[model samples]
Target: MFESLGAFVDHLRAQGKLVDIDEELSPDYEVAAAVRLIDQRLGKAVLCRKVRGCGMPVVANILARRDLLRLAFASPNDPTEEYLRRIGGSLPPEVVRAAPVHEVVHDGDFDVAKLLPLLLHHEKDAARYISSGVTVSRDPQTGLRGMGIYRIQVCGPRELTISIGSPPVSDFLAKANATGKPLPVAIAIGLEPLSYFASVVPVAAGVDKFDAAGTLRGAPVPLVAARTQPVEVYAEAEIVLEGEMLPNTQREDGPVGESTGYYHAGRSWAARLTAVTHRAHPFYYALVPFAAENTLLMGVTREADLLAALRRKFPSVRRVSLTQGSVAMLAIIQAAPASKEEATAMVRAALEGSMQVKTAILVDADVDPHDLNDVQWALSTRFQADRDLLVLRDLPGSPIDPTATNRRTAKLGLDATRPADQAEAFMRIALDPAARRRVEEILARLT
Candidate 1:
């Protein structure tokens, strides 16, 4: 909702989820550091109305918490299940002619320094980065489109070194490279918060990302063809940049701090830019790349992948949770596994589907898989470390993983499910629905 982002911000302020800063905020590590701190201490979105150099106001941490996420994915229910069910639904993106993002254009004098509040995050980061750009690209061969939130470094007013690896988009970019063609891509920044979450879904190649965005919103996302390129982009997008990744173009991308609260270097892939453009008074959107949004976006992809893997072997798999604290590396599955081997197989399938996954636990159906304490408790009571814990080594984890020691890392699977022969014995809580409903009704009335 290009037109409605202002309304959403107003709503956030009314609901106490948005923080307004009218004081001087610098584009350097100052703004970035503050956003990082906001994410860590009191998770909330921030809108900086004043920055030291820029004429336009800058809004950072727009998707800082579940409150903002709920706003993005709002429906009769909540954002998580409501948005996810859409992903599994048939709603396709409906393209429109044009919108507000194209109201003004400035191409030849592409100076991000003059416009956006490009931030230098860590003390050691090489230069200021356009860290939260939603890069959109199309397969040169099949013409299929993909998009993801990728980091871009502000090398010059005319250039942004985009990271083109790490998933569905990268895989397609690789295919475009092998065929000796330039990857036609566009970066769309600053749209409705729900649109940002929709970009991060790691669906396989050939699947349209915009359609997925539409499905998640329970409607079609409107798109406009970029003024400079063939790529159709978010017409309501505040900033859109068209570019090309020439075959074999590469660079030394990062040593920046990542999601694990540590540093990673040389894992960076590279690309070249062709054009940079935005709205006349574009409010640049950036996230503290390693903060809450990063954790949530990545975890959502992991959860999707994990669910797919589990359902393949264990048809009884009821739920799969990618925990908030342990990151995507840890997964817990709720299942009615018929055998010990079947429980173990569920874990194996999870690890195989997710390249970065480090641990998987199979638990009895009675326990809520979403709770880490419940999973941990299951591990403590039902699992024998020597017998039920299976450790795997030298697996390929997420290259972005700071915790994984290269190919030397190990993944452990815990078979926390009750023994197949005694399934009924460990079926812990035995509450009748009528009794539970009566207690709920009494609590509701008293409150």
Candidate 2:
């Protein structure tokens, strides 16, 4: 397990998965443009050594691909299985006396925009955003800790607006607001992969994400108390912003591009920044909203959980794929269904299990769920819309879904598995093994 984000970055550099840019770049659009170009060409994480105005360097696209996710866990095998194994248990975090985050603390005379390299990713973005800050909070009554990735809008030097959506953190803020008290919050930037993964997973209310993160790392995560808040943050985090979500207060927050590839109008609630602390010469992490890294970061853990949830109900479920291009709205399942009834049941289970999954397609175990072409082939040959289509209307849906009306939308499922009686008719054409081997040998010599 990595001790800090710096360690993870170093590991990525050693593996040739990261690139360093010595050229100066502006935080507004230049840094984001460079990241997008590199993501399209090389798909490597970038570390910009100099920014136009900021003192700290900026890093982007840290988890842009599945291979990088595997590398984060130091696992060369299946990433899903590795992720499942890591988060299967829980371990409480350990508190430490000192932390790198508190090495340089600024309680007064601080300007967030001037100090940090916040990025303006899209052309229509209202302002620079903190897209990757893992906001941490706790229940005032039960003292249950919650962590989540929230969009923080830079409104002023000490004031910011936050998007508190459907997550545990929102609930915590609500409970605190009921008491007419500002909810204490700590935003940790540049965290290790395990901590970041745990923050995004859907867990029960009152569940501590730090414990979950410790479990994923196979060791207890070290925590240090924030300088300006009661909340504790990852001791090794590169930067930590301590603040409070003001009660009965709201402001314009966005029109910023989200992971769903659309601009969401700004929310009302705002956070009052109290202190900004960081390690000396910290790395400013930037996550370009609607990018590959944004999709994978949100979808990978959800896919693993969905796979486990489906297998518990249907043993025949071999694999589950939350298609990256669909932004996690589409799910493809590879399973061996005994009959049409069983295939339909599996589809229903998948839809019921994951609220974000709007489209589900069930294929035979022979078809690769991860391969879009193979899934499409199954849909073409085995699926009959009249007999296999399952549609649910007027259901609660994701707010990001453009088709959703009044927060409700329709769900579609297709059973693409071949009929049991017509197995021979749907058999796939195969290449002779001896002839394929001979061809491979000839090609190898030619190369």
Candidate 3:
């Protein structure tokens, strides 16, 4: 596996999965537009070497493709199962005395907006955001280190606001708030791919995230102490922002676009930057909200957990896939149900299983859950809306979802599996094995 972002970028370039633009692009919108277009059309990561004002280059859409993720796992089996297997063998992080991020330190007055090329991804965004920073902080209660990706809105030269939605950090904030003290935080930006992926894992409370990252990478992650904060950051990280989340400070955080393809504006916690550390020439990592990379990173662990839960409850569940275009709001499950009642139960379990899953489609084992076309065909032929569609009233839901009312959402499940009574009638048309093989050989030779 690649050890650092630079090494991974080099690998992407060698594999023709990355494109570099020498043209000067504005961080306001131009860089985001180009990144979205390229990712949608060719599914390539973008590296803008010349920003209009900032000196560091910007890279986005690197985690958009599953093949790239496969390279990280280096496994033939499912990534979710692989992650589950590797996570059980946790490896502790190794502390280091020196790191490249400490080579250049800004301990005094400095403007964050002037230092990094923070991108304004959406038109209605309240301010520029650092979307890809993996924030590392310790739980005040347990003293265990935790990491998560948070949107850091740059408010001023040294002030900022962070969205503390997930736990360990939120828990840390609560404990600090109770004591009228600030929680120290270190935001590490642009590390290796596995570091970011592991940070987002829904690890149990009190579990150290750096160890989870090290487990995924099959090696101990080298960590260096933050200069200004009491936290530790990945040693090979390109940049580290040392700060403290204020005890009682509140700020209007967004109108910024989120992973749900909608603008989310809310009052969030504020923080003050104490120091900024980085290498001589660091790459600024940018993530476009509502894009494949954002959704994929957010959904990877969710899908894995959902699949594991569904399987434990219903042994018939074969596969689970969170549709990428839905922003992790939709899940397609492939299963072989023993009866229509069992199928409906599985569908209901799926919808209620994950918070992000607002729509669940249950397809038969014959259909490929990952392929939308195959799932659609199954839905068209095997489903009867009146009989198979199950809708539930308002329930707890993801806050990022635009359609939710008061953070409550109505969810639905569609059982697209062929009814056992009509199995013969709904039998698929197919060619014989020998004949299909002969045709495939001829087509292969012709190609």
Candidate 4:
């Protein structure tokens, strides 16, 4: 696996998976527009060498596609499975005296707005956001470190409003607020792809997110003490913004376009930036919300978690996919069940496995869960509304879902497996082995 963002970018360039944009682009909307267009076309990540006013370059769409993820994980097979295997255990981080991120330090008075190329992702966004920075904090009570990607609005040169929506960051913030102390935080931007992916993995309480990154790296992740904050950041991170989340300080920080493809307005906790440190010549990373990268980064780990959970309950569960078009609100499970009851049970297990999943579909083992066509076919031919459709009401759901009512939403499960007794009657036709091979060989030569 690549060790640093620079190394990964270099490797991607070598593999023709990265594009260089020499034209000066504005961070207001042009950069985000280019990232969106590239993602929509399944194109390479862009390296914008010139921003209108910023000194550093901007990079976006770093890992928007499955092929890019495959490169980062160095997996010959499924990257999600590889991630699952790596996360089974963790390697502790190795602290060092100094690192490249501290090559340039600005602790006193600095203007973040004029320094970094923060992107304005959507037209309706309240302000330019540091959308890709991984917020690293330590639990005040347990002393365990945690990392999470959060929406950080640029309030001023040295001020930010962060939405502490989930745990263990929220849990840490509560403990700090209980004692009336500010929670020390270090926002690391432009980290290795694996470290960013590891941050979003739903590890259990008391588990250090840094250790998860180490596991994904297959070696200890190097760490360095922050210049101003009482926290450690990945030594190779391109930039680190050291700060503290003030206790009992609230700020109105909303109307930002979220991954759900809607504007979400809410209150947020205020943070005072103490310092900003980075490499002398750094690259600012930007992530466009509601884009492919946002969905893939959040979906893959959830799919792995759901697959593991379902398999533990039902050994017949073969594959699971968090459909991207649904923004991971829908799950498709491929499994072999002995009866209709077993299929329905598997679907329920999937929905319960992750709060993000609002709809689940269980298809026969022959169906490919990742393929929408295959899943739709199974739903059309094998499912009956009265017998196979299950609706669950008033269940807990992710608040980001705009369709949800007061954080409560209804869920659905569709069993698309063929009737067990009539399985023989529902057998699918297949091409003859010799004929198929001959046709494939001819097609290959023509291509």
User: Against the unseen true structure, what C-alpha lDDT does each candidate score?
Assistant: 0.73, 0.86, 0.88, 0.88
TM values, all candidates: 0.83, 0.93, 0.94, 0.94
Residue pairs that clash (backbone atoms under 3 angstroms), model 1: none
Better of 1 and 2 by TM-score: 2
Identify the runs in model 3 with alpha carbons over 4 angstroms from their true place: 421-424, 430-447
Q: After superposition, how far is residue 16 of candidate 4 from its true place, in Å?
A: 3.2
Candidate 2 lowest-lDDT run of ten: 197-206
For model 2, residues 384-433, the per-residue Cα lDDT tens digits are 99999999887777667888888688899999999977888989998999
| Winner on TM-score (1 vs 3) | 3
Candidate 4 lDDT over 275-340, as tens digits, reads: 999998888898989888899998899889888888888998888888878998899998889887
Error of 3 at 216 (Å): 1.5
Question: How much is 169 displaced in model 2, in angstroms?
Answer: 1.7
Q: What clash count goes with each model?
A: 0, 2, 0, 0
lDDT of 4 at 115: 75
TM-score of candidate 2 to 2 decimals: 0.93
